[model samples]
Target: MVPQEAYRPDAGAMTTAIHVRGLTKRYGDVQAVGGLDLEIQKGEVFAILGPNGAGKSTTVEILEGYRKRDSGEVRVLGIDPQKPTREWRAKLGIVLQTANDAAELTVRETIRHFAAYYPMARDPEEVIAKVGLTEKADVRIRKLSGGQRRRVDVALGVIGNPELLFLDEPTTGFDPEARRQFWDLIKGLAAEGTTIVLTTHYLDEAEALAKRVAVIARGRIVAAGDPATLGGRATAKAKVTWADGLVETDTPTRTVLELSRRYDGEVPGLAITRPTLEDIYLTLIEAPE
Candidate 1:
């Protein structure tokens, strides 16, 4: 386990965007989080990847001030989330897996209503346009498709112009095109300096958006680093593939050079590949204590 001090310091000129130490949560006898420690910098797109019932949701809920922890130190944007003030609440945005249904309201109407809660809310029209729902802005919530409804949910989340955003499987029900569009939206928000904390089962999503990622299992962080190199993935052995066979070895360059010698210069259908995030993720989840 990482020491509590390691995850303590704030990042950037403003210090840390989020600092957590010894974060533990329990539901009856089941420990949801066990001495978790984490530090996220400002303007970073950090991802949390974990298997089902691994405490991902529990941790996020605590950070969001939706649940209380058994014992821990948590500072989100320099304030304890468990004791959120109105100002602190305004700085944070959350897109949960499921949003409440505003059945009788139009997409635009719903956004406008939610915006009223925040002191520094963004323009309702702008929020709608940003989430790519301008075309459906007039449609009632009960009449829009699932994907469109999800967009409305996102619109509400960012309506406050929050400094940090929490996205929990934001694209779970999206189709391919919708997912791609949503990714772009997230990128735009991050580019504008919104610190984002994402939790998703999609390894591809984490690889595409997260500047850094943490993998959790059994309520503990097993690995945390840049997605490309987590679990020594970038430095790990490469798989050299040819028309007839494949070989996995640490020295892929040497293997390719040797294959060239046998093939008299050019090996047929030759390609070298390294383990993908998905591959590493599955292995990490399946490994035993």
Candidate 2:
């Protein structure tokens, strides 16, 4: 849900779905988030990544109205999250890192019960099918596998028909297949105009789904941009590999062209690669705080 007392947007400002400026949070001497600023457009799948204790969760909690910020301005759907109201809460859905236990209830019963909380909830049967849990609808919660249980968690999150959805490390325990299915489900939701904010350690997952990514370290944002071009990544040097050895440089195309002349043909095992999101992320996090 969102806060009702935050600034109200004019018609033109409504284009941006989420906006945060100089956001900060502290616990005594420790700073959890230091003057963080971010903006997300509507219907965009944005990913936030960070090392442990980097204030990622804290920032998200503030956005979700689960926790209060010490300072800074934040807005979601034109409302301040800190002053969350019923109408604002109704427009947001959240899937936490861990779902609560309802061990004795069947999957269908659980979803049905939660659906009653929303004024415009999705159809229970449709949500179950969308999450690939139609077959487990009648199965008891305790008997379901970990991945299947996660699907149930997603079902509950979307049952509210929220305009914005927050997912924190959603596929932590899923296998490859289940993870793919979940990614597809997220894409489907975004396609339907749902704004999504996600946090995860899986760089590959971020690359696959996020239109843009933000990397945080030591309670501050280190880098933010498109996944492929974060931190000048697209313009960074490429690593060139050949049968003899490998070399890294900014002019990969020139290197390949010269190598082709030297070899009089295609160079054996010739490959060119740029730094991956994970590589850049690790480098950013390990830098001096």
- Give the count of colliding residue pairs in each prediction: 4, 3
Tens-digit lDDT track of model 2 for 1-289: 5665454566535778789999999999999999999999988999999998999999999999999999898998888998999888889999988865998999999999999999999999999999998888999999999889888888888999999999999999899988999999999999999999999999999999999999999888999999999988888889999999898998888999999999999899998889988889999999996
Q: After superposition, how far is residue 146 of candidate 2 from its true place, in Å?
A: 1.1
User: Which pairs of residues collide in candidate 1?
Assistant: 10-15, 10-16, 11-15, 11-16
Error of 1 at 145 (Å): 1.0
lDDT for every model? 0.90, 0.92
lDDT tens digits by residue: candidate 1, 177-224: 999999999999999999999999998999999989999887778899
What TM-score does structure 2 among the candidates reach? Answer: 0.93
